[model samples]
Target: MHLVVRPLSTVKSSLFYSTSSHVPARAMVYAQYGKPSEVLSRMPLYRIHKHTLPDVKPQDVHIRFLAAPINPADCNQVEGVYPIKPPFNTSLGSDEPVAVGGNEGVAEVIALGDQVKGFSVGDKVVMAQAGRGTWRSHAALPASEVQLLPGFNSQVSLVHAATLTAHPHINVDNVEHHIGDYVIQNGANSAVGQFVIQIAHAWGLKTINVVRDRPNLDELKEYLTSLGATHILTEEELSKRETRSKLKGWLDGRKLRLALNCVGGKNATELGRYLDHEGKHVTYGAMSKQPMAVPAAPLIFKDVSYHGFWVSRWTDTHSRQEREAMFGDLINLIKEGKLREPVWEKVSWKLNASEQENETAFKEAVNKGITGFGKGKQIVFFED
Candidate 1:
C-alpha cells in the first residue's frame, strides 16, 4: 500500500500550506550544542516558518514526515558529543546557522522534481545518509539524500520504519555469520540487542544473551527467550565459574564466532573470553559510559579482533543501492514476522494546537527520554 499526502484544504492551519512552490514547515531547532532541554528551548517551537521549504529544485523531492525517533545518539549530537554533526545552516529560516535534532524517521513524498526518477509522489522513504535533520514536519530534500523502502507494505509498521536506521540488525548483518555459529552479547534487552537476538535466530545462529538483573528479571528472561535467544544470563552469572562451565557444556567444543557488546565494562571482557580463534568482537554502544578493559590474551593467542560499528559511518560509506538492498531485506523480514519493532511510545503532534503547546509536548518527551524514565523508546508521531 502507498501513503498519500493529505490535501492542503484538509490541513487544520494555514501555517502548513503555501500558494507558491515553497511549502511551509515546522522543526525542532538548536543553534548551539549543549543539553537538549536547554538548547532546544532557546527557540520558538516552530522555528522553521513558511519560507524554510525553499522551492523544490530539479534534484529535490518534497516530503511530509510520518514519524521520527529520539535516539541516544541524537541526544549526544545535541549535546555536542557525537562524532558526526549535521551541518548548521540557515536553511531552516534562521538568521544564524542551526540544525534539526533527529536523524532517523520515515516520510511520504508529497512532491517530486522533474529531474528525479524512480520515486512516485506517494512513495515512502527514509534518509539515505545521516545528518539530514528529521525533527520536522516537512522538508525538500535532494533525491540522492533519501532512500525508498521498496518493500514497505501494509504489514511493515510505521514504528519499524522510523527506527530502522538505528536498529542493531545492521550490525548482525555486517558481522561474520555462519549457520550453527555461536554469538554472544550484552544488553540483551536493549533495542539493538533484541534485534540481534531475533536476526541471529532467524539466520540459524545460537545467541548467548547477558543482561543486568532487574526486579522482574525472570519475566524479562522469558520474553527474550521467546524471541529465540539460545541462552540468557545476568552480569553476575556471567562472572561465575559455574556459569562458564555451563556455557562450555552448551557450546560442546563449538566456539563463539562473534560477540556484540553494548555495555563496556567487566561484562564486555567476559564476552570476549568465549570468543573462538579469529573471532570478532563488535562494540556499538557504551551504555555504561565506562571503558572496556580488554586483556591481550584473546588478541595474541586466539587472534580475536575488536571493532566499533556506527550505523552513521556505515551508511556514509555504502552506496545507495547497497543501503536500499539492506533496507528491503529487513522490511521483508517484518512482512514475514521474522522481525518485530522495538518497544516504543509515541508523542503525538497535534496540527491544530498552538505552537507553544506542541513545543511543550515535544520537549517533555525528549526530557523523559534523556532521564530514562520510560519503559520503551520515545518517538514523535505527527497527527493530521
Candidate 2:
C-alpha cells in the first residue's frame, strides 16, 4: 500500500483546490473522536480535509465513489461509539493521524492493476465490510476490498446499489424463518425493518411490523402494508393485552418464531412478549438508546433465545465467495422486483464545487439523518 503525504503548504490553506497531476482527492476526515458535527471537518475550518492519493499499484484498483449513505451506524462510528473503528492513519495527508468517514457506498472502478485479473475498469463494486472509508471522491484499494454488483449493470440503480450493504445482510443473517413461520419486528419503517418485511414476504414468511404512532398513522400503516407487511401496529397497540389476543387470532395457532428489534427499552421487551416457546429475538440496532428490559418469564419458561446481529462482523467472518454470493442473491431479488430501494434524499458532491460547499452539504445530510427530519434515508451522490 502506498502512503499519502501532504505538503506543509497545503495544510496552511483552509480550502484546498488541487491542481496537481500527481495526486488529487478529498474526504471528510477527523483526527480526534467527538460529536460528529464538532469533530468532522470539511476544510481546515471545520473537519473536512483534502489529501493526495497514491498511484494505483500492481495490486490496486482505483475507484471513484459514486454514492454513500449517512447511516446511523456511520454517525455512531464518527462519534467514537460504534464497535468497528476505521484504522486511524496519516493516509489522507493530515498532519495528525486521522481516518475518513463513511462505511457503506458503491464505487466505480476507473483504473485497474496489472495483477488484478477478476475486476475490470468499469465494474461497480461495494466495500467487502465496514471501516473502509467510502465518504470521499476517490480511492485506490486492493481488489479484495470490494465485490462486484452483479445487478448494477442491469436493473439495480445507483441508489439501490449504494444503499444495499447493511440492511439486507443483517436480515438474511439474523432471521432464520421457514416459509410458514411468522416474524415480528419493531422499527418497521426503518431501512432494515422494511427489508425484513419484503425479504420475509419474498420467502413466504409472515411479518407483523411495529412502529410508533404518528399523525399520519393510517397512512404509514398503509404504506408498510404495501411493502408486504402482514400487519402494522403502533407501540401502544403491541403492548395491549387485547392486542396479544388479536395477534393470536392473526397467527391462527402458528408460532411467532422470530422477533427483530431495532428499538430497545420497553418497546423491545414488549416485542418479545408474543414470541412462542423456543422463539428467537434478534436485536440489530438501538435507535431508542435504551436498554432492552426483557422479562425473565419468556427466557426461563418459553426458552427464548436472544442474539445481536452486526453486519460488519458478519462480513468479516464470511469468505469473499460467500459475500459475493449474497450480493448476487440480493441483485436477483432486485431484478425480480421483489426487493425495492429505500426512500432517500440525495447529498450530491460536485467535483467542481469548492471544498467548503461540499463539506456543508454533507454536514446537513448528517444532521438530517441524526435528527430524523425526513421520511427517507440520506445518501451522498458524487458527480463530476
TM-score list, all predictions? 0.91, 0.90
How would you encode candidate 1's per-residue C-alpha lDDT over 92-199 as one tens digit per residue? 678778788889999988776656777767688999877788988888888788889878888999999998888635545445677888899999999999998998
Off by over 4 Å in 1: 1-20, 40-52, 168-175
The Cα error of candidate 1 at residue 229, in Å, is 1.4
Name the regions of candidate 2 deviating beyond 4 angstroms: 1-23, 40-46, 169-171, 174-176
Per-residue C-alpha lDDT of model 2 across residues 264-341, encoded as one tens digit per residue: 999999888888888888898888889988788889999998998878777888888888888888888888999889
Best by TM-score: 1
For model 2, what is the C-alpha lDDT against the true structure?
0.80
